[model samples]
Target: MLEINGLVKHYGDFTLNCTMKVEPGRITGLVGENGAGKSTTFKAVLGLITYDAGDVTLLGKAPSELTEEEKQKIGVTLAESGFSGYLKVKDVVPVLAALYPAFDREKFLGLCRKFGIPMDKYIREFSTGMKAKLKVLAAVTHRAEFLLMDEPTTGLDVMAREGILDLFREYMEEDENRSILISSHISSDLEGLCDDIYMIHNGEIVFHEETDVLLNEYGLIKADEEQYRNLDKEYILRVRRESFGYSCLTDQKQYYLENYPDVVVEKGSLDEVITMIIGGEKL
Candidate 1:
């Protein structure tokens, strides 16, 4: 449902060049460290910022050419959603509802109740988690087909975060045409939610793969110097040697397991894979 090709953005010292696609009924996770260009990419797609070069299409229309009605079909929740502190939840919800043609007030209120956000109080009186929930409630209440969420769970506690994730899952199940692009530093949030992941480093996409392929195809191996010397170099992506042994990141875990029966081969998580890719090992 969304496509970005040859996206290039430059700001003197920092440069971002990324290309990827997200199809309907899938959640794509945009992961990277601070200043890795995740926000820049999002802004370019939303037409909030102009890129140096590339094409961005959302729902078959270029973002730059989209009308206000077309733009209303997409919802966005940033790390900090700007809500006037003077407005009460009761007043804020309707103001947002008036902007979209398909705003569902009943559904919105239900979500607010489910999330335990106090509708009677002004936004300034709410905690960070409460305000975050309020912002998400506003975004989802309109029933937008596509969502661009930047750290939607940032200020939320464990329970609140889980609730928000469940809401996303429910929303996706409602229609096969709906899609979401979520950007977050919390790797665990995307582990089970995203169908595919794109890891950005140095303002470029270093890796983009199906989540299952990554979990099943790669692993971490720890071995003594002699065992390390015996390993085939082609399978290794990175290696770090300690005084007594080495820790290696490899794509062919099964091959390594079969050949080096004595070495320890442990399955790697998404976080570990990202770390290895961003932080090159010292040999």
Candidate 2:
């Protein structure tokens, strides 16, 4: 439902170049470190920040071309931007209801109650986790077909995060036309929820792959200098040097396991793949 092509943004010395797609009825994840270009890319897609070049199409229109009515149909959660500190949880309901024609007040309040958010208290007084939860609740309850969430689970504990993830899954189940694009540092959360994941670093897109291919086929080979040297470098995607040994990432896990029976080959996670790609050298 979303398409970005050769998107480029520049800020003094920093630059962001990204390309990807978000299909209907799937959760696509953008994972990166704190200073990575994840946030910048999202801003560009939403037209919150003007980019120097490229095209961003959301729901069949350029972000800047989306009318007020069109804009209301797309949900958004910005990390530190949302309701003012002066507003209480109850006060937000009316504001959102006025803004989004299809907003479901009952569903919004139900989500707040389910997440244990106080209705009468000022949002400023709420903890970080409560604020984060409020933003997510506001976005999903608007009846938006598309969702762009930046760090939706931040400041939440394990239980709260799980609850939020389950809510997202339920939202997707409601309609095959729905889709979500989420960026978070919590790789484990994405592993369970995302259909595909994209990795960005230093203002550029580095890798994009299906979640299952990453989890099931990708692997890591931990070997000493000598063993690392002996293996065929063609299969290595990235290699990081460590004090005791070298850690190599490879998509050919079965190939390595069968050919180099002596080396230690283990399944790799998203975090491991990112670490090796950003920190290691490519073949």
Candidate 3:
């Protein structure tokens, strides 16, 4: 449902060059460390910032040139959204609802109630978690088909986070035409929810893979010098040696599992993958 081709955005010292596509009914996670250009890429996609080159198409129309109807079809919850602190929750909800043609007031109010958000309280007085919840509530109540959420679960407790995730799951099931692009530092949040992951580093997309493939096919191998020497170098993506042994990252876990049954093949997490990428360690 979304296509980005050779998207290039340049700042004075950093640049973002990325390419990816999101099909209907899929959740694509964009992950990277702080200042890794994750937010820059998101801004470019939303046309909030101008890019030097490349094209961004959201549901077939360039985001920069999207019509009002097209814009209504997409919902965005950024880290710093344009919500005035002086407005009370009740006032804010209706104000945002009026901007969208398909907004459901009842649904909005219901979500607020379900999340225990006080409708009468000013946004400035709410906790960080409450503000985050309000932003998500505003985004989803409009019934947008595409959601670009940057850390939607930020400041939320475990229960609250899960509830929000469940809401996204339900939204997907309710409409097969919907899609989402979620960027969060919490790898666990993306583990089960994202169909695929796009790992960004130094303003470039370093890795893009299906979530299942990533979890099942990738592994970390820790071995001694003798064991490391016995293994084929071609199979290792990165190797770091210590006083006692070496730690290696590999994509071909099955190969090592079959050949070196004695070698340890522990499953790698999304956090590990991101760490490796950010550290400039091979793949």
List the global CA lDDT of all models: 0.86, 0.92, 0.85
- Itemize residue pairs with steric clashes in candidate 3: none
What lDDT does candidate 2 reach at residue 213? 92
Put down candidate 2 lDDT per residue, 218-260, tens digits, no spaces. Answer: 9999999899879998889998888868999999898999999
Better of 2 and 3 by TM-score: 2
Clash count for each candidate, listed in order shown: 0, 0, 0
Q: Which candidate has the highest lDDT of all?
A: 2
List pairs with backbone clashes in candidate 1. none
Question: Order of candidates by lDDT, top first?
Answer: 2, 1, 3
Per-residue CA lDDT of candidate 1, range 1-283, in tens?
7899999999999999989999998999999888898888888888888889888988898788989888788888877655899989899767887788798888988888888988889899999999888878777778789998888888899999998888889889988889999998889988879999999888899988888777898898888989988888788887876676987888789998899899999897788788777765634
Top TM-score model = 2
Q: Which stretches of candidate 1 lie over 4 Å from their true place?
A: 281-283
Candidates in descending TM-score order: 2, 3, 1
Q: State the lDDT at 120 in candidate 3.
A: 85
